[model samples]
Target: MAHKNQFQLLASRRFLPFFLTQFLGAFNDNVFKSALMVMIAFRLAADQANALNNLAAGLFILPFFLFSATAGQLADKYDKAFLIRRIKLAEIGISLVGVVALISGSNTLCLAVLFLLGVQSAFFGPIKYAILPQHLRKTELVGGNALVEMATFVAILGGTIVGTILSGASDSGGGSEWIGGLIIAIAIVGYLVCRVIPDAAPPVPDLKIDLNPVRQTAHVLREVAKTPAIFYAIVGISWFWLLGAAYLTQIPSFGKNVLGGDEPLVALLLCSFTIGVAIGSLLCERLSGGRIELGLVPLGAAGLTYGGIALSVIGGNLAPLEEVSLAAFWGSPGAQMFLFHLALIGVFGGLYIVPLYAMIQERTAKALRARVIAVTNIMNSLFMVVSAVLGIVFLSLLDFSIPQFFMVIALMNAAVAIFVFSKVPEFAMRLLVWLLSHTMYRVRHEGLEQIPAEGPAIIACNHVSYVDALLLAGAVRRPIRFIMYKPIYEIPVLHFIFRTGRAIPICSRQKDPEGYARAFEEIEQGLKDGDLLCIFPEGQLTKDGEMQPFKAGIEKILQKTPVPVIPMALRGLWGSFFSHKDGHAFTTWPKRFWSSVSVVAGKPLDADTAKSDHLHQVVLGLRGERL
Candidate 1:
């Protein structure tokens, strides 16, 4: 399957209506949130204003803790189209209440409506996420998620910009009355658009609603924990929220207190972050080849910390804390660096989140996905709350400055990333592949989709380098069980990864007859388990960058399994870093940096026609006589 740009998804009905509904919902969310924040910052006393701002943040998040579990059950129990329409209708009601509160100029009433809107959003979260797999084909999952992320962050930027501008209008907009009506209009439009979204059958139509949030939330999370990858993806995703909430929550204050600017500057910096996320989110599809490339998650975490630290120190005794015009701010030497840091942080955030989200969607059993998302939403809310608490503790109790707080978060981010990636080895595996494929060589994969997305198959390849297995693993979307010689599998550095990946390590029959017998049993069991099995038919790496005689082991395995065999070849790896160039690999310097390589996959062969000799020739032909 050839990958298409994310923008192509915009033309489809399966995506557009849901996209508009989600975008409008996010837009309305930020419009109200930004307006309230501005009021708390400007119209109230300093201490009370800070208190109210934090209160507003808590009010919006509390509903996620209270309602998300039940909402997940409801989404699973009902048609998503009907549920979304109802949620939008709830938004309209909430907006009506907001308008009344705005007219009355009552902060109490406004906060109440904020909570109600949060409740509406809590119900919408699971539906928005779980409905996608129902709408898009499997290959489109990553692109769909990337587009959704792009829309979300962009809407956030647009709404924040408009909300901040209107709050300063010195008219009814600034006073909140007109802005409330605007939110009402947006809510209605979202509802209308949601009407066009096709009905999505509920995953668990008989799901019983359990009203106890704490118990149900625990149950949902426990179910998700059954799949460690999905669970860790949720954790990684929540950690990202922690980073986001930290930056976004502190940005306005940081801008005013440290950067010597006011609320408008805060808006400007946030716009920069949002734009970066949009660009990064769209780029994720291209970078990952429309697959769940969790490798980028660690890269993103590292960039986030790096950018955070840069932003923290680079200001270097910036001008005094007072209002500065945009002209003066732009002219300042640190301005561009500061903006770059913020945008870089956001870009990495996009990279970290898009793949993790797609992975959760792709890996979870479809019937329970909504509940899993609900569990994720609950964790996200919890993480954001912790971020708020951390900020308060850092600033109020520790008496730390804003930049100092950032320094602490950045340091903590490194620790968190190490821990999370250690827990999920796949993330680290992909990271290795990404680093190798991107740094040492550029890998151009051909006919990758010929490898079936599911079922048992033999991935027979002519191995040329130590990294050949990794090359195939990275290029294919599915996880492949590699059969490697015991000596190579026991290489000190990669032994753990091979163990984690469940690579079948085989010893020669002459060396250990029993071990060799176990190897065949393992291979048969792997195929019986419907694994995608990869084998180097030569039984070892190429000594002269040429194909060795085909081993009989592959024929024995094929005779036992009788599965379709996919012929693949690794070209351009002959003189690469891991290749046996000039004697042993890594004994000398790499002859080339950023070398080019390719993995050519051929059409799957019928079980009846997949004789070992024929398969070897097929792989040679696909290798373009480079063999």
Candidate 2:
């Protein structure tokens, strides 16, 4: 089937209602949680409020630990559309209970409602991630995720602000019955929207449902561990939540005790942070060219650490404002600096998360994608719980101020990022390419590790620009033999470059059957010589900047050579001066001396699994949707 357009995907009944359902669910959650927090800070006795607030936070997150395993199983076993509708209905019931608690003005009852909301969210977790691949195309995953994240966080900011305002209004009136009513109304809307979500059939429809959470959780863990990359991605995701939960839990306390800001100011701080996250999420689709680019993970982590340090320094410089204005909310010497740090945190937070999410979706088997997401949800919950406890320790035992706490967190983040990148050099390599492309033009790669970086290999890339082979040569440490078109090999000016590089040329079977036969023999000889041969499987440059189908010539070569095939993707070359775009080569140079380009290489695929169609898809995934 042809891929759906982005707008169509966005507007479709399949995605929109589920989007709203999740959005409203997130919003209602923050609304109640924030409202309760406001009550603890402003209305209850200091000791009593602290105890109640801490308990509420713990109870809410407790469900993730207890129910996430069950949730994953259910998501993998049931139709997600039906499951989501049920969960939304559950939310309505929970919100109604919240209404009764609010009317009674009982803090205990309100806290219970918070716990129940968390429970509902935990159940929705697996289905939330599991349903996407069923509805969207491979190319749309990153953009879709970005949109979802943007919506979720926007809901969070709005819910937080609305909840705080509503709680404050009720306190002034000596009651908060209206806050409960507002939550119930939102829950109703969430249910209605969920009913409209498109149906997603169960992946493992006949799979057994594990009623025992402990055994089930263990099983899920084992399942995930089967794929090391997926497991690490889960760890990466959980650590991010740990960092976020730690940072977010401290914001209100910091605003009030450290910055001496009021409730409204706290809302402002949250708004800025969420806005930064929203903007960053939107940018992910563009920056990654609508694919999961794990390289951004390190970049995001760097931002988080720096932003944390910046916040810490600004907190240390806390001073009273000389003047206050609407702009001063952000510019008020104390608050302005604080908001700046928060915004930076959010920006980097966006960069860090969007790609990890895309990676999880892309790498996992489609059948288990949602279950993996549920695993992530559980991990996030566990980390947040750990964070809350550590936070308390830092605040009480260590006598660390909020800013100092952030500084410590920032340092830890740097350490973790370095470790993860070291383990996954692909991220580090991409970072190198990203930096180099932004700095130099006409960059060329050669030697490619003297052709045998490890073993016999066949390197395949799309035919795009005149300099593609050069760029690949420059980036690879191995020496490689290029299989060029006959004409390009015979070109007067370029022939010497190819000859010096030891490139081989071949004509099509129709043009010269004997020549094609001889070229395959040469490739086989090169493989026997333990040399790496790079072939452009697309055979010719794309006239419209889209990948053409593989020419099947490589199939014959691979059939004969029997070497590992490593697919490479070259991006930002289509619009370059030497590209087939703009009617011809070297006709239109970029305005800048250094145009951004990327040469992404995937891990080697065994000759057994290196079918032409599979290789094509892998290349497309690597090139991303934009190419």
Candidate 3:
């Protein structure tokens, strides 16, 4: 049975083992990387340490660009469970080599181990996401992704803290042995946990492997481009990483130069951001009501902008202090605000990324999912590289203050978000619908599962308010093509959503025969194209919070394209802000916020039996005096 709470998945055999395996792998990677960074800082000259650190970062990221294509192919062509086991086994060997290098005090060998670990991670990345849809139900995708994201950030923080502590407690090379031991132990445990992961059969067992990275990368990019939604989702996801990298890379400097703080203050700032991201990520499942809610993406993106700007402002206004401890820094003016905005950035970031990941997995074809994810990985790597270079250009070359650089990033994020939302209005449309249903009304859905997951179906619902279509769009899992009245469809602001959503706008035959004919023609084509369509069979909103008689237009539709008709109803929307209870929608103040509302879907009826009067009664019964 699927768990209602995402946390409950931790107790399930299907998810727990796999989750642990990945968690351990991430933890181990960070522990090793952080320890190595600290060791270099302590033992080497400043310039040498800096150069090696940059090299380490680049080496770790290099594998994603070089091996992601082959990794994607391998993941699709083999059982994911088996591949995970072998990968974990390789990790064990790599950890042993790392131990030997640490014991010998060889930085060269240590860097080599880091590069090898990067290769291991690159191979694991494709399998990490591709296996999700195979193991999880559609309802659990958002929750699963939420948990993964939360675990990832938490693990990173924990590993960084632990590694720093371990290194700090030792002199010179003493911490190296402990780090090596911990890494090896984690790798072994990861292998053992992965052994229990349920089998995920290969999606394309006979697919040929493409060893040519350049050629395969081009191929996979082309494949992702075939689906504009998936491509844009990848782009959005990549942009998020770029934004995140900028914040993470600059935090230490922001603390030292901007806040005039020491290591403890840096740790505090990191904690604020990391914890915020964890909180935000966990909230995704709840805020989305356990669905892949794309609306959160825009909300997150906007929050990031606000948070970044807030941080920049706060940082710019701060008076400088010299080598202050965490406590001293906390006493600084604007310190609390800085931390809050940092956390806010993380929170919104969580809201932004989880849905995009779930959407990619849900939409991509199984045969090509891994390869597409590989392309995503490549994009992420490319973006991170660009982010690093931009950081240099902005701060180092241009002599811009960290606060100024942050403002640049925030404005850049805003621009990217606007461009993406314009190209993919579905994100913006969903955001509007989500806001309307979540803020203006407390929407409860009933029998929504009656709507087929994939098929051509007609939804005939009573129109109680002007915003009924938007409310229904928010409630339903599938994308819906609303057949809207022309005037309502042409309403400003709403018109963008309606048009972008591909709502078919119709007028009375006497008003505009051509438009009416065109609307029907579009409806026929939409159904033939296998879209889930919704029509307000009442033809217009009720004047007195009552159902209007269903129009014959639905019957005409069925005669031309006979498909299943699912009777649906909107209840308790009367006297609400969008309703006509007080003259007209938006003409008067809303009597209350979060008004109780319900959307009910009745069992499907064969098109032949779904007459106008019958659907009206069915909808009326479903509403059941709730208005």
Top lDDT hit: 3
Ranking under lDDT, best-scoring first? Answer: 3, 1, 2
lDDT of 1: 0.85
Model 2 per-residue lDDT tens digits across residues 336-359: 767877988888888888877877
Q: What would the TM-score be for candidate 2 when compared with the true structure? A: 0.74
Query: Over the stretch 124-204, how does candidate 3's per-residue lDDT look in tens digits?
Result: 999999999999998889888888988888888888888888877668447777888899999999999999999999989
Task: Give candidate 3's TM-score.
Answer: 0.95
Model number with the top TM-score: 3
Instruction: Tell me each candidate's TM-score.
Output: 0.90, 0.74, 0.95
* Regions of model 1 farther than 4 Å from truth: 1-3, 40-48, 168-174, 321-323, 439-442, 446-458, 512-530, 554-567, 587-596, 601-618, 621-624
Q: How well does model 2 score by local distance difference test?
A: 0.78
